[model samples]
Target: MIAEENFSSCETPFLSISSRAILPHIHMLMKQAIPCFINYIHSENYKKKNLNEDDLTQIYIEQAQILIRKHNYPFNVNGQYRDITNLSKGFSDFYFFPNELGVSTNSIYSVESKRLPAPDKFREKEYVIGNNKNGGIERYKNQIHGKGLNECGLIGFVEKHNFKYWLDLINSWIEDLALSNRNWNEEERLLEIESHVDFCFLHSKAKREEKDIELHHFWIELGNGNSISNSKK
Candidate 1:
């Protein structure tokens, strides 16, 4: 079985206590990764209380650690990226619900993430593999990137290298789809999966022109609604 321990059980880690120090620099990072992020808000527990940007950032960071523990991927939680105009060196903009499976302990929650196309760039942005920023897995230094799953047993994707910005696209799709009158449940979950993959391909291609662009990739595993690993990444 695909268990969290299979990835994160380790002596050294991709992220350490020192990684927490990167929190102060996240504000600028969020801007570049998700231009619309400032307008969006998330609930602290979804049912408990409303959250501001600070609360959301903290949650993103905390859950990232849990996700790392579950996925056991090698990423410097405090790693930096340069020459990206919209993002900070080590910041992740908005992490979606499905992208946050590691944090949800309740069995009731479904896993999912969403992405939306930019309004002005929609035409130029091909949500296709060949034309979009995602040049495919073979082009990246890390193979498993921008892959996320949802609560309704659906899996979505983004490019691993450009995950921070791509997350914005995913959130936009989720928000729009959730608010639409269309019955998402009626369609096969595979439809959504295919849509996600397409979006990743297109978004990756669109951003390829950016000078010195980079993304911090995150992978989340939700097993029966709980994280399976004891060791935190």
Candidate 2:
């Protein structure tokens, strides 16, 4: 782990090592910021109002930025940030950049967010593999999102099921897809790391013809007394 420097000098983190080498530390900051992010959004009266993925994500970033400043996380959040390397690749749902100096380097961590059990049938599989090639996991697999980074994030606004249910369900989708699709593979299934009352963390991998990358899955349960079905998990 890199030594924590005095980020008081600047807004971002200090990167004495390579950008890739410093990502693990940045990841830790995100893990700390996420729970607070979820709490802040729900406190804003999400259950009563209908907030789409983008609206919720923007809210998440807004509060996450506050935490970043309060705790001096040496990183900041940007919603719908464009690819610094290739604009043609389109926008990522969230981009985490170092406080200041590291932003110019390659320390960017790109993440895509999706709603679990999607709103409609046509986009039902979007959290894993979308019908329109816009799936959260699919983008990283195809290198359309996290093109150069070795690790990226998949943020799931779990609108229906619990984390345990989605953990099993998403893996089933990957297993089924691997059987027929040339690009999909069984190894891409998510492995649960830990589950809390507010959030769950999982890990997976994305492999393709060219290369593979590690994927960190974070699911935040937002349903209010509203499990379509019930499970203790």
Candidate 3:
């Protein structure tokens, strides 16, 4: 059993999807919440400050907890959650712990967040593939994360440029890697689902070891507006 703690019972509107049978339902729900969180942070109307990856992750958790409690959702969002199944693999940025009735499970949906254009110039490729091979995509490709799960996610905090700009750049980088890296292929490029002025969502599939790992990519802009319009695609 995955740990069940800190959650209190509450009345909520029923959502149709079953927790154990449908992982995609959880994925969709989580994706839907991104714009909400983006708006949640912006709604505060505080003086704009440059927030790092961790800051954004924390904000996401806070917003998710609100929904979990309000809706009685079985899953929980955890930051820096370790994979107890693999003690040495290290913690993921966001672990959507799959649970039943608020009880945790071994099946974890891990997501690693990255900053587009990286905070430093020297680490420019860190969004697609990192210098130390810890790039958002590289981690799963190298078995650094999601070794057991067939799917994982990545979030790009677009500190610079638009979503299309980074998407093309990242796909180009992946195509370049496919030339020499046997594990990489052109098929791993992110394909767009939808986008707006403030957020973009895409999906990609990558080869990990002998199996295929699906990747869901979300990038949120933190530029001039920092808020999404016509929300929730």
Estimate, for each residue in 60-100, the C-alpha lDDT of model 2 and write its tens digit. 77877777788776566788867766542767888887665
Error of 2 at 173 (Å): 0.9
Give residue 166's lDDT in candidate 2 (0 to 100): 84
lDDT per residue as tens, model 1, 1-233: 86655656544323332222432233223222231222222223242344332343444445545544565433313211121332222222233221132432111111112111211243212221213333221112111222221111111222133433544554454345436724211121111111121122211211211221122222221112211121111
- Looking at candidate 3, what is the lDDT of residue 80? 82
Q: Cα RMSD (Å) per model?
A: 18.1, 7.4, 7.6
Best model number under TM-score: 2
User: Can you write out model 3's per-residue Cα lDDT over 10-69, one digit (the tens) per residue?
Assistant: 444344455435566666667667777777666646225445667777777777767777
Q: Which of the numbered candidates is closest to the native, going by highest lDDT?
A: 2
Clashing pairs in 3: 130-135
Return whichever of 2 and 3 wins on lDDT: 2
Error of 2 at 69 (Å): 0.8
Q: Candidate 3: deviation at residue 126, Å?
A: 1.0
- Global Cα lDDT for candidate 2: 0.75
**147 in model 1: Cα distance from truth in Å?**
22
Candidate 3 lDDT trough over 10 residues, lowest sum: 224-233
| lDDT, model 1 | 0.26
